[model samples]
Target: MLAAATALFALVASASAQALPSSAASPEQLALVDAQYNASGFPDSGAILTVSYASFVVQNGNAYTAEQVATAPTIYVTPSTTTRDEFNSSSVYTVMLADASSLGDPDTEGNYRRVLQRSTHYLVNGQTGTSTGSNYTFEPSGGT
Candidate 1:
């Protein structure tokens, strides 16, 4: 009975190991992903952006799968027009997943979600005037 139990344990271990993904991204692949992300121009603002999280997904193709999370910087802008006091505010956070080639360029199959908020304030002659209310949009790619 002990021998049989040992054999069963070994079988379970082997099966578990086999069930894991063999094509997981390596450190080099992750570096490539970072480079691609930096060059993608997703953050076109002056605010500093940084990656908060990253991971890999296993798929049935030659492409490498990666997911990244990033944050946008708070922006404040004032218009020059003296007739009205105008200020703009905006912020965004994003999550993206992509299937990339060996060179780290995103392929056709990818998805991204961005949580964006923006507002414009206007004061005519320093008095309370018509102001654009804050707007929020949760944009996401159309895919499962």
Candidate 2:
């Protein structure tokens, strides 16, 4: 039992060190997501945008998997974004994502009902990228 616990701990630690990115939503993408959030008055701001993960292509310098990427609640902060129309309409932008049981319980308690939120940092028109800090927050569904 003790050995199993140790192994589990090691696995989690390693995963954190290897957090991954699903997709790169350039600055252009973020602008769209932001517009949608602002227009919606931040109404479940996340739902207005779409988020997903595929095999990590390459960013600064790292390889990642979908499961590893899903551990984080802040998908947008990592490098994801929304469409052009969505960015133009939203005032505040955030990325919506599905959380897995291993990471933690979702706030909705429903598997698909869960989501991750991220706010915008800076923006530029005609540019296809945005810079994001490591700022993010996760809201779980239940106390369990």
lDDT score of residue 119 within candidate 1: 12
Across 7-84, the per-residue lDDT of candidate 1 in tens digits comes to 011001101111222232234433433444465433212211111112422222323212221222111111112211
lDDT of 2: 0.27
Candidate 1, overall lDDT?
0.21
Model 1, runs deviating above 4 Å: 1-43, 50-104, 110-144
Off by over 4 Å in 2: 1-24, 43-77, 80-144
User: Cα-based RMSD of the predictions, in order?
Assistant: 21.6, 15.2
How many residue pairs clash in each candidate at the backbone level? 0, 19
Return the TM-score for each candidate structure. Answer: 0.17, 0.20
RMSD of 1: 21.6
Residue 134 in candidate 1, Cα distance off native in Å: 24
lDDT of 2 at 10: 8
Q: What is candidate 2's CA lDDT for residue 140? A: 16
